[model samples]
Target: MVKQQQGAGHSAEASALGFYYQAFFALLTLMRQDTDNAAVGIEQLDDVDLKVDGHNLLYQLKHSTSDAPPVISLKSKALWKTVKVWVDILPDLTLSETTLHLVTVAKLGLDSPLIALTNLEAERTELVEAMVEEAQRVLDARAAASKMGKALPHADRVDGCSAFLSLTDTERLNLMRRTVIQPGSAAVGAIEDNVAGHLKLLPPEQRPAVAMRLVEWWDRQIIYSLCGKRERVIARGELQHQISAIVSDIEHDKLVPDFEIASPPRDYQPDGMLARQIQLVDGKTSDFSKAIREEWKAREQRSKWLNGSPAMAVTINDYDLVLEEHWSDRHSQMVEECAELDQKGKCQSGLEIMRWTHENAPSTVRPIAQGWGAAYYIRGSYQVLAIDLKVGWHSDYAKLLGDAE
Candidate 1:
């Protein structure tokens, strides 16, 4: 067993590789394309990485029990290196739809699978083989349909995540117009027009020979959608975990440039596309942007709460319990310090003031050193009560964080 504590050690990038690998199979299957079945084996995580439709992907797969974190910071810092590498690959090839993505997937180990087959190896040495065969079948079906002039619609890429062009001519052209496919973009033409050329400019030495290797890979491998038919439930769960982690980071002041959660996440519609798009998103970027914003707000609020209150308190008036808090230690300390300055004769200056909260906290909260103690804030013709003070002896940060009732 590993250290099972909050903010535990990192996991490996390989955890996500399975999902990305699945995605590759999905892509191949979707394309109605065919290729060789064997891994070219230039090396794993060395001389070669996986490229699909010209996009380079780093797939990190981890088991549930795995205890390594993927190289998120390393990849972010080394982006320029990858860019230079991409520059080396595009010159002699067509990389019109290329992009780079770093993916990490956490998966269940092979001891349990939905379909249990005896003699199936625990190492899953045959799983990839089976997946490839299934992918080919899916591709063949697609090919047969396409030949009959019946093709399925492709999904649009989620922005800030990945970009994908549709198999249909109209959508593909529109996507092409909206994006530049080359490495020389931003330096040359407009952002949209230049992306394509930017990709095409990759150095010839790194380019895959389109006539054989690219086609062969396409034939041999297949990609399945990142989302399965059961994706809605999985998406909700994954999204929640993702959102919660981000919220925690913001609360800790760890997320830079700030994180905010917009009211909704995406502009979804009932039976429209994403059922909750509008309710879940706001502004230009929608869910991706909106979610982070709202989460930031909640983090800020929590920081504010934690600052003003303590885990517990001893109080008069029957020792009333101030159950939940929403402030941070630093901010609350500053608030108390300002109050102390006010109590003493250390008068006026802008530094003497923080953001003006209500002149009074609720009555249940009596001021103590924790700073989160409550009092009454004036309401029109009345006073409003807050949750800042504790009258009783019970305290739980879990409840404070909303995990407990």
Candidate 2:
């Protein structure tokens, strides 16, 4: 019993890997073909492994973990199970338009009965007759076991074989005619190679980076669809747009900003020098919260940028210097305008300076890269400087924070 449980656990893990392969295979299909209206769905429409709407194709993906997987022959359970699924849904499909596909990593033997299904020119009448004979043999064996008061271990396979026998001769021939077997399909690790192959138009050195970005984005999109966060159908146009965006970023030397909509933790409280500087000028609670959120996003994005090429590090340093200069100029202007004002009036003027900086500073500063327009990155960078005492909002921030001039 313990051994059986371990085997079941291993099977479940392999099944999960199979689902991932299915998603990758779908992505590969989208990349290889040019069909504007085609959309792909996972685990929908009679619970087929994959359903490509617009193309009228349903796919069953069988993945194995072994380096030397067994052959998919006439009596292979995976083949019959896939056939059984299609047979059950045959009533709802248009025989002339719909195609059923069984995609597996297992190799097909020279004498495999399903070989005829792979070839459009092959005569399928003989194949249909042979399937009927095999189905009868399976049913007879189950009958023999029942007469001996014993249960067959694979009752599901027996049921699937029986289901095939119930179809009429015309239905059987039409079903066999539309079925396709794609043996030796790409495994989990090799799917990456297949994806890169479809990107031959790209420069050889850029293919890997582009493939990685596309695959990562595809995985996230699949997860979102599965989790009900978005529509389940993945349109080909959506994938193409993402590819274009990624390529554009790489070519233009731009950083794609992440965490743009991210928020601080619910229990987070504004603290430290940045918050103190805001408070010194009578900044409101909303101002403090926005400042903290923007600072967090900028710091996170900057850290990620620094992890890249040395050129990116230099870009960030230069951008920070630009922000500091902007703050310095603004601070000097605020001091001059409020020179004759009393303490309360000076504080009011300082608040106005902060408001203007937040509203207009992003537009004045030079972006780190061409076509990159994440204003939060600019706003957050200024807050980051204030946190480190390199810049601040109020005119007397240095003295208020007890910093050396």
Best by TM-score: 2
Give me the overall lDDT of model 2: 0.76
For 1-405, candidate 1 gives per-residue lDDT tens digits of: 011111232444433333333333222222222222212211233222344344433322211223432222211212223323333343433434433222222212333221211222233324323423433444456567778899632111111111111123343232223221111101101222222222243343322222122322222332211123231111222323433454444345341211121232355221221112212112134432322333334334334434433432222112222212312332344445555454232222111211112222233234432333222211100100111211101122123322211
| Cα RMSD to the true fold for all candidates | 22.6, 6.4
| Candidate-wise lDDT, in order | 0.27, 0.76
Model 1 stretches astray by more than 4 angstroms: 1-121, 153-357, 360-382, 385-405
Off by over 4 Å in 2: 1-16, 34-39, 46-55, 223-238, 259-310, 320-367, 373-405
Model 2 vs. true fold: TM: 0.68
TM-score of each candidate structure, all chains considered together: 0.20, 0.68
Steric collisions counted per model: 99, 0
